[model samples]
Structure formats: C-alpha cells, structure tokens
Target: MDRALELAARGPAHGPNPRVGCVILAPATPGIPGRTVLGEGWHRGAGTPHAEVAALADARARGHDTRGATAVVTLEPCHHTGRTGPCTRALLDAGITDVVHALADPGVTSGGGADHLRAHGVHVTAGPRSAAALDLVHTWHHAVTTGRPWITLKTATSLDGRVAASDGTSQWITGPQARAHAHAIRAQVDAIAVTTGTALADDPALTARTPTGTLAPHQPLRVVIGHRDLPADHRLLHDGPPPLHLRTHDVGDVLAALHHHEIRHLLVEGGPALAGALLAADVVDELHAYIAPVLLGDGPPAIPPYGITTLATAPRWHTTTTHRLGDDILLIARRTATHPDPDTEEA
Candidate 1:
C-alpha cells in the first residue's frame, strides 16, 4: 500500500501516464511468519523506467530471487504496448508468479494487463487498497478515459461554508495546517487554475510555496479561466513562473485547453463563480472542501450563483477520503460514472 501511495505521487510530474509503484514480497520461513518486502520500486522521473522493472532490478540487486514471488502494485500493469514495452512482459521476465493490485488501469491502451498476466499463469488479486490508490491518481485516470483532465474544486471556507467575510476579506480562512495541505495538492496537480475574476479579486500568487519558505521548482502551471484580459500588474501573472492565459467562455473549453497542455490533473483554487461554473458544466471530477470550524453567516458562500436545483440534478460524486488538517476538515469526492444532462445550462 505504501508503494502504491508513493507511486501515485509520480503522476503529475510524468505526463500522460499515471505513476505506479511496485513491491515484491517473498514469503518467510517458519521462523518469520509475515511476508518480507524483498524489493520496492517507483517511477522516478520522466522517461526513466516503469515501476515494475525498477522493482525487479532492486530485488536482483538485493540478491533476492523473485522467482514465484508475490508482487503488489497500486494499479494493474499495462497489457497493450506503449512508449515502454508492456509491463506484463517485464513481470513475466522477473519470474513473479502472484500479483496483488489496488486498482485496474482504465486506459484503453492498457486495460487488460491483469487478464494477460492471468493467462500467462500468474495469480492476480485486486481491490485491496484500490480506493486509496485511485484517489491519488483520480484526475489522471479521469483524463485518460474522458478525453479531458479531472477537475478538483478546492476551497478554504469557514464552518458555515463562507469563503470570505461579508466585505470580501477572504485571507486565511483556514489555519496553517490546511494551507500547507492545499500547497501539497497544488504541487501534485499539473495546474493550479482559477478564473480571471478570482485572479483580479484575490491576486493570489497561486504558486505552491511551502512553509519552509522553499518553492516547488516545477510548480504547477497557473491558469486563469475566462476571456477577460488580466491586468498588466496581475500578481499571479508576474510571478517567477508565468501563468497560462486561457481565453474561454465555458468550462468545457477551459478543460479542452488544459488537455491540449497535457495537464491531466487540475486543481481549481476558487472564487466561487468558477466552481459553480465547472459544477454547472459537469466538468468537475472531484471536490476538495476544506471546512474550517467557524461561522460567518453574511460572508460569500463557498459556491457561486447557480443554486443546485436538486440532489438528483447535482453531479453525483463519491466521498473518497476525509482527513483533518488542523481545525479544518478536508473532504475529497470523485465524480461518478453517470452524467446528468450535459445540455442543461446553469441558472
């Protein structure tokens, strides 16, 4: 599971393909009951090597024979051919006999890796820690299958779900811990996007600046939605990393532009209107709501204008994970398979 989680961390950095982690487990003798982790490998950098191949090499280096060993992975290996050879071939070559996976690869180019392995006399089991693994690469997976990047609507709001004070003073609604966690999310995704309205209103840096005063060298691309021209002095645009100016009227166009940029994962750090627009367009794939325990009844609502008509009409999502960051509750939700009416416009 640790290997799987670590593998997921590789995705945004490696474009097009989701990062994977693998571990080879060798059964212990009578003296040692639990299986020993013989070797572990993660996709290190862009175009390096696949996770399974790396893990096998590690096992060999450690003098651990992988013949008949059990391999645990975060996602199913690739069955079809790609830039790298099929992972199924590598596993077979490594003499791995058993496989455990968290989730199946949803890509058309690599869907049946597990089936291919089973056909080749490998025992495969799936769905153990699958949800957690999927959560990590949810955006990437969504993009591969849907032809657009997955959108995560993230906001820091008060206990009453207000994003700002009544007078529009919205700085630091959540504590330090929640802000730190948000930065981590920004680092993981391909782009940190917001609307031009948000850019004008907040003038946020949008770059993932860590608490240690260190900036992520390859910070996510900052994108501003909408066709409105940004001010020459826009803080987000003038920062160290240049922001992408996307002139689009609709959320779908924004998503298409992001896809063109090879941004498989997008974090929407909002100003409500953008969030509501994405949700209304049914383009949002996941939501990360940071609910701080405070109340400001007259403040701006977490989401903007369009009142979600009904629970049924609302885009269906599944709660993937909920963690506590300081006094804030971080809730993560993924889009469901069903799509409501794509033709309907938001009120």
Candidate 2:
C-alpha cells in the first residue's frame, strides 16, 4: 500500500481522474513470510490505463506468472468501463486471488468495485492506511462527491488577525519563509483565486516559482473574481497562465464555473469580503493562515463577520497541522462539521 501510494504521487497533479496506483504480489510460498513483488504501476491521467491494468501488463511484460497473485492498490479497482476496460475484469483475468485497497470510490460512475470483486469470488480487504490515502486525493474525491470544486482558503495575518496596517500595506505581514511556503501551496492546486478588489489593490502576479524565482513546472490557473474589470496594465493580465475572470458575487456560482473548467482544487487568496462570503456560504474546505508576531490593531481584519452571531452558528474547523515558518506561525485546518441537513434541523 505504501509503494502504491508513492507511485500514485507520480501522476499529474490535476486531471479529470483521481490518481491511483497498484502493486502485484506473487503468491506466498511455504517458507516465505511475505509474497515477492511482481510489478507496480500507476494511473497517468485521463484516457490512460488504470493502475490495476497497468500493473498487470507490467507483470506480463516481465514474464512473471501472476496466477493467484495478490493485488494491493491505493484506490479500489474500478468496476465499470469508461476510458479503459474494467480493472476488476483485468484483475480476474490476471488470476488475482486476493485484493486489498484503501479508500472506496465515492464517485457515482466509478464506485462499487469492492462489492463487484467480492461477488465474483475474489477475496477483498479494505481499510489499510485509508486516511493517508484519502488525504492524497481528497480534493478530487470531494469534487466528485459534491459536484463542485474544493476550496482551500489561504490568509496571511498579524497576531491581531488584521490583514493590513492603517496604511493598507500588507506586503510583509509574514516573514519570507511563510511567504515562500504559501507559494509552494499555490504550485500544488489547479488554480489560485482572488477577488478583483485584491487583484487591483495588490497587483499580484500570482505565479508559483522556485526559490530562485523561476516558474514551477506546474503553474496553477490564475483566477480573478468579482464583477469589476481588471486594468489594462494589470500584472495578472500578462503573467503565468491566462487569468480567468469570474464576474459573479455568488459563491456557489463561482464554484460551479470552476468545476466546469476542470478545476478540482482551488486555492483562494482573496480578502475579507470574499473570505467572509465563502465562510457564510459554507463552501470552504480548508483554511490556512500564516499568523505573524506583530499586532496590527487598526486595519481590516483577515476575516470579517458574515452573520455568525453565536458559537453554534459559527463554522467549525479541525487543525490539521501547525508549523512555525521563520517568524510566522502557519495554521492548516479543515472544516470539521458542516451545517446540519435542512431536513434534520429542529424548528
């Protein structure tokens, strides 16, 4: 399972399909405590062979007799055929006797593989390193399950939660290390988004770059929100991937638009207005804050109030990690529990 996950990370960071990996193990012998590894493979991207099939093909190419082998995979082997044949069929054809997988596919079109495999008489075991496996593809799974884009909100603030000083200068709220770490976050997602007010005020290029200031191999799409138009001399108009203008005030609309653009994970770096709106809409999946040691008591807060009047009404988040980046402290968290279902709520 560990090797499968490592292989899964080798696939593209953004694509229509979730990254998956598979490893085939030769049947156990009388004296051997563990089976020998036959082959390993991972799903490259859309329109490619799935991890199970890829691993099977690799085993055959190596002249290994895979009869009664065990298949260990990061994700459940897919049961249905889309761009490729069913991985269940491939595993059966390869004479795989047992299967072990991490997470169950939540996708409507790609789920139910475990049950299908079990019904066909293959021994299936689930839940090995499931949490870690989910973390690798959480954004993809969320997008698929909800039919919308997954949002990761990033903020840089002072100890007082102020985003800027009285002069409206926020260029150095956090130290260089925290800023560099934020850029690394920008490089991993499908898009980096900000409101038009932020774009105009900061004039940020929003390009992820190496420590040497060169562009990273994976550049996220630059997205600007709000109904306002960008100036002709704007840096966003001329930097990195072309800027996508989402002229809307509705948070749901913004996510729907991004979803159509193949944006599974969107990193939002907008200001208070947009942040508060996302919070009120309950659409933010992850919240990342780089808190500096300085106090800025007079400027706008990093997040403004958006109708939360009590503790019960306020959003809940669970801390995932806390790291000290140079002089700043970074807080990484995910939403703990969403609002109760409308049908289940009391009057």
Please report how far candidate 2 places residue 62 from its true position, in Å. Answer: 1.8
Candidate 1 TM-score, true structure as reference: 0.75
Off by over 4 Å in 2: 12-14, 30-32, 81-85, 119-121, 338-347
Q: Write the per-residue lDDT of candidate 1 for residues 1-347, one digit (tens) a residue.
A: 77657755764553567777888899556786788888888776556667887888899999999988988989898886666788899999988999998889988777999999999999999888888887766667888889898778897899888999999987788988988988887877788888888888878888887888689655888998877887878888677768888887677788888887878888888768888887778778788999989899888898876768777666677899999987889999888877665677799
Q: Clashing pairs in model 2?
A: none
The pairs that clash in candidate 1 are 159-294
Backbone clash total for model 2 is 0
Instruction: Write one digit per residue (lDDT tens) for candidate 2, span 1-347.
Output: 99999988888767667888899999889986987999899999879999898999999999998889999999998888887888999998888989999988888878899999999899999989888788788889999899887889999999999899998988788998998898888888899899999999999999998777888787889999999999878899876557999999988888899888878999999878999999898898998999999987799898999988987677778899999999899999989877654466577
Error of 2 at 73 (Å): 0.7
Tell me the deviation in Å of residue 59 in model 1.
2.4
